[model samples]
Target: MSKVTEVVAELVSPIVTDAGLELVDIEYVKEGRDWFLRVYIDKENGIDIEECGLISEKLSEKLDEIDPIPHNYFLEVSSPGAERPLKKDKDFERAIGKNVFIKTYEPIEGEKGFEGTLIEFNGEMIKVEVKIKTRKKIIEIPFEKVANARLAVTF
Candidate 1:
């Protein structure tokens, strides 16, 4: 996480939790000549536009009061969508029996990316049932090796 994102995440976490939402992630990036600060928020069922607007309003007020960012940037509060990122231990635990896409820092079983049903997550490792050709195989991935992971919508 970048310094700006870390600061913004700390700033918005309380607001998000108070609103009965989870703070999914924060992104502070430069797109062309503009800077964007995107706050991803969600709940069990999902998040609505009204919820996003409420978070955006509350966070905007807080940001204005603190002036955390030196320059202008867009503050967008929205949902993590269908492909929600699995960042925490609880996230991985909850992902069991669900389809997910995982990318590892180094290749495991000669593959860096795996997409399949998450069979298990024991904090130390993840077991995914993937299909290779006509055979189903269970791939064991180290939790520490995961670079990125998200819910995958399988067709």
Candidate 2:
């Protein structure tokens, strides 16, 4: 996370938590002449458009008061949706028994990416049940090796 994103997260965390939402992720990126501050939020029952609008309004007011970003940027507040990224330990824990796609920072079992069911997450390691042709195999992945992970929407 960038310094700007860290500051923005700090500013938005309380607002999100007070609203009964979880802060999924924050991004500050420049596209052409525009800078965008995107905030991803979620709730146990899922998020709706109205919730997004509400958060945008509240965060906008707060950002106006703080003015952390020097340049003009679009502030977007919305749900992480079905394929939500597994960012924190809690995210991984909540994803147990769900189908997931994970990428490792370094190769594991000669592969960096794996798609399977997240059978377990016990803080230090994740045990995934992967299908190889007709058979199922369980692979244990250390937490430190995970580069990225998200719920996999399989058709």
Candidate 3:
């Protein structure tokens, strides 16, 4: 995360949590000539359009007051959608038994990525059940090595 994103996250988290929402992630990046500040939020039952609008309005007010970003940017508040990225320990824990896609910082068993059933997360480790042709294999991934993880949709 960039410094701007970190600051904006600190500023927006309280407001989102107060509204009974989980802060999924924050991204501040430049695309072409535009800078976008995207805030992803979610809840147990999921979020709706009205909730997103309310968050956008309230968060915009707060951001305007703080004036943290020096450059012109577009602020977007929305749900993380189906393939939500797992960035926190709680996210990993909640993802147990679900299908997931994970990319590690370094190769584990000659592979850098895996898509499989997230069998368990033991706080310090992540165990996934993957299939290779007709064989099923369990891969243990150290928690610290995961560069990215998200819920996966499989047919």
RMSD of each: 0.9, 1.0, 0.9
Instruction: List the pairs of residues colliding in candidate 3.
Output: none
Which regions in candidate 3 have their CA more than 4 angstroms from the true location? none
lDDT (Cα, tens digit) per residue for candidate 3, span 21-140 = 989999999999999999999999999999889889988998899999888999999999999998898999999999999999999999999999999998889999999999999999
Model 1 worst lDDT window (10 residues): 1-10
Candidate 1, 3-121: lDDT as tens digits:
88887888899999899999988888899999999999999999899999999999999899989899999998899988999999988898999999999999998999999999999
Tell me the deviation in Å of residue 105 in model 3: 1.2
lDDT of each: 0.93, 0.93, 0.93
User: lDDT (0-100) at residue 3 of candidate 2?
Assistant: 91
Reference-based TM-score of each model: 0.96, 0.96, 0.96
